[model samples]
Target: MRNIRAIANRELLSLFCSPMGYIVIAFFLALTGVFVIATRSLEPGQPATLRSVFGFMPIMLTIFAPAITMRMLSDEYRTGTIETLMTVPVSDLQVVLGKYFAAFLYYCVMVAGTLIYVLLMLIFGSPDLGSMFTSYIGLLLAGAMFLSVGLFASSLTPNQIVAWVTATIPMILFVFATNWVVSEVDSAPAIREVLQRVNIWKHMELFNRGLLMTESVAFFLATTMLFVFLTIKTVESRRWR
Candidate 1:
């Protein structure tokens, strides 16, 4: 636990020291703000709303979460810090968990940034607080899952660019391709069912509309844990080689 906290603190500090974190936050805020303005219209009678702002988050997260996590283990290995890290008294699992949690926390900040949009909407118009809360909950879970995938990709290679691309490709597939697959396989009920099951877009659809489904929650949790474990295994396997 002590080691985990130390590792998490180090990771968090690294993020604060780096300019990339600030850049990411700025880009998302600007992009989401534009989305809100466009969706709500420029007219004074049509005030801005949180619905459109939150709607942009999943796509933003799909891109930004990889940027935040793609370097987690890969950068350490690239710079030869992995050796020093491995020599520490901490177990590998603790290191992986700590780093994962730190990245997760960073992603949470990204999600929290959208709160400003919610506040703006509240000032302009009535917002459904319950739906807003559930929507943000869904974003949190989605970000966690994406971060876990990025961590696993980082563990697979010492090249950060390669890790980032690898992490991003599957997310793109999950977000875009699965829907296409479902559309194409109209006659194959079983195939469509499977594609829907694998589709992050399908799972996220309900959440975006403020519908809280247990199955979607379970899917996100399972996907996150699966990738986290994969990352732990990837890191552990390197010890033997």
Candidate 2:
């Protein structure tokens, strides 16, 4: 527990100590703001609901999560810090979890900044509190999944750009490939249903409609754990390497 905290703090400080974190945050907010204004002006739905902003998050996360996590292991390897970290009293699991959680938390902060959009919606129109809360829950879960994917990608390479690219590709596939699979398999409703079940878009859509389903929650949690475990394995494999 103590090791995890130490590692988390170290990971977070590394992020804040650099300008990239601020730049990524600023770029995300700017793009999100543009999307909100464009979508709202063209078709002003429920006055100022955060649905539009939150709706855009997966795409943003597809980009931002990779950027944030690109440095997770790659930097340690590049700086010859992995040896020092490995020699520490902490186990591999502890180090992995610490780094993973720290990256996840950072992603959360970026997502949290978008809450200003929710507040803006409240000021202009009456938004459903229950729906809003569920939407946030969905967003948080999705962000966790994204962070895990990015962490796994980071574990595979020592180059941050390579890590970012690897992470971004899978997320892009998840969004587009799922949709494509579903579309091409209309003849196979069972397969289509399964594809949709595995699709983040479907689960996220439920939250957009203000419905919280336990199954969707489970999918995200299970998927996140899968990636986290994969990241752990990837790091541990280095011992044999």
Candidate 3:
């Protein structure tokens, strides 16, 4: 626990000192703001809400999450600092968790910055509090899953750009590809059911609609753990080499 905290703190400090952290945050907020305006303006008769913003958030995070986590391990390998990090008393799991938490925390901070949109909705409209809370939860869970994927990608390569691209592609597919396949392919009902179950966007949509389904939550949690486990294994492999 102590080692994990130390690594997390170090990762946080490193992120704060780098321009990428601020860039990600700023870009996210800017995009959200634009979406909020466009959404509200385009549907003036509809309730003044952030539904459109939330709808766009998963896609935004798909891009932003990778940018935030691209350097988690890739930079360490590039700078030849993985050896020093591995020499620490912490186990591989601890290191992976620490880095994962750091990235997750950074993402939370970025998400928090979007609170202004919520505040605006509150002042001008009666947004469903329950729906908003659930939506936020869904966003965080989705972001966590994406971050884990990014971490796995980072662990695979020494190039940050490659890590980012690798992470983004899978995330895009996870959130969209399944839905596309199910729509394009005329499959049996059972096959379509399985594909729908695998659709990350469908799970997120459930959350967006204020449905706290256990299956969706479990799907995100299970996938996140799987990637985290893979990242730990990747790190351990490097240690043995």
- How high is each candidate's TM-score? 0.93, 0.94, 0.95
lDDT of 3 by residue, 1-241 (tens): 9888888999999899989779888988998889877877234466766766788776777798889889989999999998988886779999999999999999899999988877876776777888889999999998999899999999999999999999898778767778787887785878888988888778888898889999999988999999999999999999778
List, residue by residue over 136-165, the lDDT tens digit for candidate 1: 888888889999998999998989888989
Q: Which ranges in model 2 have alpha carbons more than 4 Å from their true place?
A: 41-46
Candidate 1 stretches greater than 4 Å from native: 41-49
Q: Could you say which candidate leads in lDDT?
A: 3
Q: Pick the candidate with the highest TM-score.
A: 3
Q: lDDT of candidate 3 vs native?
A: 0.87
Candidate 2 contains a number of clashing pairs equal to 1
Which digits, one per residue and each the tens of the lDDT, describe model 2 over residues 39-136? 78224464546676677777778888888889989888788788788777977888889998898888788878877877776766677888889998
Full candidate order by lDDT, most accurate first = 3, 2, 1
Error in Å for residue 84 of model 3: 1.0
Candidate 1 lDDT for residue 222: 98
What C-alpha lDDT values do all the predictions have?
0.82, 0.84, 0.87
lDDT-wise, the better of 2 and 3 is 3
